[model samples]
Target: MQCGFAAGSPCEVTCTRVTLPDLCGHLFLDWNFSFAGLIVEEGASEWQLRYAFYGDGDAGWVHVLVAAPLAEKTFPSIVKFVHAADWHEREAEDLFGIHFEGHPRLGDFILHDDAWQEGVEPMRRKFDPREAMRHRKPDEDWRPHRIVQEPGAFVMPVGPKYSGVTESVHFLLETVGEDVIRSTPRLFYKWRAIEKLAEGKSADEVLLLAERFAATTAFAHGLAFCQAAETVCGANVPPRAMTLRVFLAELERLRQHAGAIQEICESTALAVANAHAGICEEELLRISGEITGHRYLFGLLTLGGLLCDLANDACAKALEKSQKVLSQLNALEKHLRVSSSFLDRLEEVGIVPERTAMVYGLLGPIARASGMVRDLRRAQPYLGYENIQFDVPFEEEGDGYARLRILFAEARQSVRIMEQAVGALQSGNVRERIELRAGAALGWVEAPRGGAFHWVRLDGNGKVARYRIIPPSFANWHGFHLSVEKFAFQDFPIMLSTFDLSVAENDR
Candidate 1:
């Protein structure tokens, strides 16, 4: 049954009390899972609240929900889980007014305008929305990850706006001579409280919002959102629809990978390569528009199936476009590989060790490039992925070069997947008529960047009581500093390009 109904609804998540955060480690070790989230939820009674620790597992996600009876203001921290917990926990402290006892840093993460007004948690319902949106005071400048100066080194701040990618993210690079001593990223400038805005939307309307989560992976995000709704509603997507969805998703992967590959070329100053890759990318988007009627395939996915069937000639054009894009990418890959100077700029520039990748739970090509084979497409086969035969290309280099190669390899694989999926389409209904009732479900898709996770809770009327979307970049962004460690100052742009992360995705 739907255990809880909204804020103050009994938590649908199973509650297990851990009076001490230390005990969480015992359960964590026994369960063999990693921390996915930590949050403080307003309890049914005003005298209490809850601190839930989410653990992601293969069987299903399990959360240890700790109830705090308002007798305590400070709760234990899980930074010991890994440094990754630091970000999520800090977010909890900032937005929920909950304090973490041992968190190394517990200040403004996503919420602050120069500084938060004393005694008011913007996320709390009691807080005035007008105050939250109040005009910034003169001389009050908000800088997310303010740069720290190194005694003998100079600190350089890169965009909260970088060329090529339209997002806000600040990067602090400390340089001594030509080598970078350190790098720190400040994000969330694009934060629109997407989850908060989605709270009252119907399940169908939320699908549209999901597609806007990240422009780079619109289709991937939409598919994940739909999957969660479908799961909760027990809607069986027909085989033909599933196959068509697969085609659309893979097409998105090819396009995004091409665009990222092009960005890398821009950073490396390969004008010719960048132009050609851009052309390939545009062609892919054009193909998507032809088949799904939206360049990003935004309107194509629905609760039970696609909004409609692919046009009769859609498959033919998709195949032709994919083949063309694949050939262009192959040529670009060859050019970069043979260019000694280009290869030199990329090789060993930014190396994130395999151990570090796993410790931080890195995702997508970043993890794959570091010798971690954790692509969910193969590991947790969702949708029609289990029906398709494809390869997930990985590399051991863990450097800019390896990341570039991985992008190219993954794009090639996307092309192969699209071709196979197109060939597998059969005649069947494309949409299933089902009602979204009160329930909750978790769904995810291996987006081009990495695994995008969506958790949805529907009210009795099928309106979204809650929806949390964690784009892959949200997890992948943490490992960025590790990749750039000990790299030269001039390589910063190139290294960043290799990752091609979307600050908007993480910021949202």
Candidate 2:
């Protein structure tokens, strides 16, 4: 075992596979570091696992790396210490065929037993995408995992399929009566293997997939991906591009919050309020399309900077129109606040304690509502966020209402950010020439949902060697069960709406 980098400052430490779990335990309990993500990389004759952690202020990030030969497939599970690594380990085990020796739950995660055969290991380098067509063989004896042993206890399954354009995700709500005792979420029903497909692709090509993976937060993910590529290539974006990036990012954030608020209203059966919120979301989407040529802001990010420069007049006009939309949203929020029925559904529902949020490493609005204060834009400034003035809205209640308030507050802040960014826009080029070098770097952003991380390694040929994404959904989904359990089954949809998690991001 050898340390690859220094003691701090985005360091990486290499250790034996046997010692990995203990070392991670020290980092978690002793150091009080937050678990960020886990990535598995393929080597010529071995496989490497990289565990990412968020260190204290100025320490930035710390990564622990461990490798085992292909023949020695099993590795120790760190879930005994870092509870947040549960889903990451399960996903790795299912996709890479690298078993975790102590993982209590591994199989039937991303690949459902009813559709995909066991031992497919789609992420292995040797696996072919063409083989997917012939791999559909349902397991006749498969049953959903159950922990409730009482005779009256039963599982009420809610959706591997749902209506109205929602993606696939199954939740087993175990209850003996009206209250849910245990809630288990099963995601990644339509896993695209986007990271596996990114291998050998140019940085520009992979950027497309990153943004499209979660279309709702397209620009934020695209910006994170571009930053990773820019770091690997040693390219610096122009000042104008940085300001515009902030402008567009806030634009996306505002639109996303509006949509989330709409969903929350709909969940409470506030039809009139839902209609108002939906109108606000639609208006913002229109403004986004008018400014960026895409309602979702696709094709707007490139390796070095944005794909094209935005005119100051257009950006300013868009900001003004968006501000009007924010005003309407604020009015709707004010009305909903006074509506006792609406308040009853959200005020005390789906509570996630501050301690539970931190233990699970929750992100974005979910973390903020729980009083975690883990916004990456403020903690680690990027894209000129340090130069901009905006507040990170948070609430202490950690309830459904708290999350909803965070969305409303954040939407207002987004408008303020865009206003500042538009006024500070510089006159210069938006793109820069890149010299793609063989290196790995992490790019991150305080996306609307929360902090998103993108890790990229480029080969000497200027193609991506490995691309790993830790979207906010992937982080927050791990903790979704915390809010669902102990609550009545009637509160399920309301709680789910407040989380505003994206299934597409998780499936990627």
Whole-model lDDT values for every prediction: 0.75, 0.88
Error of 2 at 239 (Å): 0.9
In model 2, what is the error at residue 11, expressed in angstroms? 1.1
Q: After the best TM-score superposition of candidate 1, give how far the Cα of residue 87 lies from its true spot, in angstroms.
A: 1.5
Number of the predicted model whose TM-score against the real structure is largest: 2
Question: Tens digit of lDDT per residue, candidate 1, span 65-168?
Answer: 56656546676776675555667677767766778777877775786546445555656646544444553363435444434455676767787666664567
lDDT of each residue in 1-508, candidate 2, tens digit only: 6666644237788988789899998897788777878988988998889998876457667889998888888999999888889889998988898889898887888877788766788788888765645556666675788999998999998887854657788889999999999998888886788898898898888988998888999999999998888877778899998999999999999999999999999988899999999999999999999999999999888877888888999998998899899999999989988999999999988999998898788999999999988678877788878777889888999999999999999999999999999889899899888889998888888888888889999999989989999889998888999898989988999989999989988788
Worst 10 residues of 2 by lDDT: 1-10
User: Pairing residues by index, what is the TM-score of model 1?
Assistant: 0.89
Find the number of clashing residue pairs for candidate 1: 0
Task: Give the distance in Å from residue 468's predicted Cα in candidate 1 to where it truly belongs.
Answer: 1.1
Candidate 2 has what TM-score? Answer: 0.96
In lDDT terms, how accurate is model 1?
A: 0.75
